[model samples]
Target: MKRIGQAMKRMTVLLLAAALTLDPLAAASRQEKALAETKAQLLSHIAVLASDDFEGREPGTDGESKTLRYIGKQFFDLGLVSGTNDPGHPWFAPVTVLGREPATSRATFSRKGKRVFVLQQDVLVYTSGKRALVENAPLVFVGTGKTIPSRADLAGRVALLLEAGIDGSDRQTALIQAGAAGVLTVLDGDHTLENVAGHRQRLGYALGGEELGGDLDAFIAGKALDAALAGTKLSVKALQDRAAAPDFAPLAVDLAVSLEATTRETKIHTHNFIAKLPGKRPAQGAVLLMAHWDHFGTCAQPPAEHLICNGAIDNASGVAVMIEVARRLAKSPQLDRDVYFVATTAEELGLLGAKAFAENPPIPLSRFVAAFNIDSVAIGPAGQAFSIVGQGLTPLDADIAAVAKQQKKKLLMDNRAEAFVRRQDGWELLQHDVPAVMVTSSWGDVTRVEAFLENDYHRPSDVVSPRLELGAAAEDVDFLTALVRWFADPRRVPYRSAAKPG
Candidate 1:
């Protein structure tokens, strides 16, 4: 018996030594396993979401329904509670969207009561609302549409703007706010009149209750403007040249314009899928993680063999990364502040879903410690550098930089990615003064991104194939997981000084 007791003691000591020796290695193995599992999940999600079965995940369609169910199931399976704060429809926040397409448009211009023959094809007028009209409003050249005259000066006048790669919606909104009766953007950049007209001719979408545009928002061909300016002191070239001056201001043109447009509208009901991982101290504010679950449905018309725009890298990859990040965070220790996961709808339709969330948040907008948006994350290889889309626009840069350093990942500190800032869902949140950013490796290499944009972007060819590089995306998942944890620590990330309105 004494011999046996001594032997047992020796075995126990050996076991304790083994555990101590293997602890670090075991932890590393576990981390590697977790990362591998996340990569597998990321691939699986992209495949499923980008498949034809999803029908491109367009809002107000069966595709949307399937997407919502899939994302909701992921959240539920991850043990995330409803972030919507609604008891009935726990996972969704309803958003009403209006889709509009131009039906009929007409415009006429005159000078000194003499008729001006502006070709009908040269002017494209349309509205996202029911109808719009302008009756003999005087034309005021606003130059590049960067600066506008006062409400007093612009009231009851049609503003002629030079399109210079400016965001049309923002410019139109500014003109509208300045009391301009109408806006005519003259083609002044690389975009041809036909391309602009074709884009405007397609269906345009906006939030249901929101105003669409100025009374008569239209695009005018530069040649057409030149023709209208004939026999006058003002010329298209001269006006464009004058626009380059630093002191350029609104100049009145001796032209009277009348325009009318009617649009066909369709109302679509959609929902934003929101879920939450509750934290210990809810008052510390929450961290938001979001990705849009939408793409162009049936982008190709009949006679095309491939009709669906399988948005594998355009955004399915993004949503997959978001989900994998959520999964990793959920398994970690409880955070000091809650973390919310949002799968926004109708992002393809001018970020309508993101706008809806910002306008009517389940939680106060000010309560968000920080919001991180993932988008188009599957473009680069494993070692590619990452960039923040809204780098200098917010105060979260330092913390993000710290995380990147700790993870030993390459981070581009420039604001080059900001070129695409207005094109993503993050822009809507940023407009509402919420600190939102898209940290992605996809945009780090502009060459690759441009190639994807030129070839597969928005095309049926954007599918789950070998060409879709996801190694860097998997790394992004891990990095973003770290970011969520770091930000969710109330001790680490300070609360906002002044909270913005929801």
Candidate 2:
């Protein structure tokens, strides 16, 4: 028994010595250090982009010049070829847009010859380029703003449209194409009058230079609209339900709308920066990654404090993720298909850069197998599932799911997918039949997304905060890096022949 006890003590001492020599915690320490370093790198870029020096990275400002230079320089240093065909320099594709601001606006809604609303309070004309002068134009309720039959005569009338879903832009375009003089969209969801007004006024746009416009577009608050339609033949709810149902006829409201607006237009030239890492088989197709680098610029109306609207999470985080992902892709072995990185400008200006790129792709649109647009990522906890916005828009969800599974993460379908789909740059590409997906980290606490939207969205308060977990963003970077790797593998083809454009 004494010998056995001594032998056991000796074995314990030997085991302790082996552990000391092996440095059992060394690998974990290295991993921790590497993670810390990556977080620092991501935060560094966010700090620079969201800093006052970038001036909110607004399009057509001096901030634009700085932003373009910064992105171009980074791409050049990365040894990426300019995807642009510029003779002098290849990184830039210029997109010209008109920035219009309303000088004076007036609108009135009357029911049965009784005035129901006055401009600047109950009604606001948010869009103005050319003067819109209409006196007592008859109101026609077009169901959900869908395309009207060509035979329908909509000349010299104002169309009351229900709020559309992901296809809102298409519906609005259809309304204009149907020869409606103007369109008034009802507010949707739990939005207040002041909130709606602020949301509308806060929006700035970069309208296509060649785009034709003569119609007025405005939004009416849901509550005020309800009050206006109380005594009418068509209640607001009935109109909404009718618009939603098929075989619904256009209801001629008991009201007419009068509108007038004056505006100032200025031209601004911004660009989308494109860079490419060539693949082993260039003809197969390319995987595209995109991120918008522009922010709100300086506040349109500066408050007493926080003059700059630093869009840290709004986009700087996204751009940083794009850069880091690009770095990883560049370092890896040659992918089966080329990878193109586009850092777009004027995204806040109604996705103008993306629209411009899709209209005239640096490479043929047919060669693009898929596109992943990175925006507003990982503001929540680490290891949360990826929220695939606009999940059913395309078959790309399968690839996202596969990637998520490989990364040991789950996929969270966005409940408000359409709202995000119509708003992001990816949707601009999707309209052209390109398989694109907008990805964000799942909000483990749903309030995180709501809080950001209610408080930080488009505000100066969007700057980086302690609440922003860089560790979560780092996890997103890893996931995206893995996604790109899996997406570009020669053995795998996510696109079916039916899905691929010839």
State TM-scores per candidate: 0.83, 0.74
Candidate with maximal lDDT? 1
- Candidate topping TM-score: 1
Q: What lDDT is obtained when candidate 2 is compared to the true structure?
A: 0.76
- For each candidate, what is the lDDT? 0.87, 0.76
Per-residue lDDT over 390-443 for candidate 1, one digit per residue giving the tens place of the 0 to 100 score = 999999999999999998888999877777899899999999888999987778
Q: Across residues 226-343, which tens digit of lDDT does each residue of candidate 2 receive?
A: 7777776667788878877878887788888887766677788888888988888777778899999988877846455788888998888888888888777788887888889998
Provide the lDDT at 478 for model 1: 82
Backbone clashes for every candidate come to 0, 0
In candidate 1, which residue ranges exceed 4 Å CA deviation? 1-34, 109-123, 138-154, 159-179, 183-196, 218-256, 408-410, 441-444, 497-502
